[model samples]
Target: MREVMGECLPDVVRARQKKAFGGVQGEWLRKYHKRAVYGLLRSASFKKREYWNHLALMRKADAFFAGEGENSFFLWQCINLELWFRKFID
Candidate 1:
């Protein structure tokens, strides 16, 4: 797909990569990392933080897992935030 786009649309700066990568990542997270995602989001450290309401965040997480919307990016951000806290603050 990228190769075809790159060949046919030389001027189009390969923008499809972002969308493709995001799709792959979102699917990957749902299929392979669901447990890890839930574990991180539901961790004591994560919930104790004041940055977000625990219930609200859990609701969002559940919705994301339920395919409520295109919330993969949001969940990805939450995962990164949790990891960051673990690395630097926790």
Candidate 2:
């Protein structure tokens, strides 16, 4: 494959390190879908869960929004879990 397309592809494109294909979910969560994500994360139903520390969750979320940390994976998991509960258990 490299031999066949290497001539047509730019050096950078052909020689670049491989990376896992990923979605912009983290960016979307932090930017485009911020309001909706925040709403779902902070909703009464979500906050009602005793396992999570509401204040800590908010602080963590604030940090993520402020670019103080890379907690997108954690936040994404939390959001998915909440959505799953709402869909199947709530």
lDDT of 2 by residue, 1-90 (tens): 767999999988888888997666779888787788789877998999876787788888889888997788888888888888889998
Clashing pairs in 1: none
lDDT (CA) per prediction: 0.81, 0.84
Candidate 1 C-alpha lDDT tens digits along 1-90: 766777767655765445433456688888899999888877899888888787887898788789887788777887898889889997
Give candidates' CA RMSD values in order.
Answer: 5.6, 4.7
User: What stretches of model 1 exceed 4 Å from their correct place?
Assistant: 1-23
Best by lDDT: 2
TM-score of every candidate relative to the true structure:
0.71, 0.70
> In TM-score terms, which candidate is top?
1
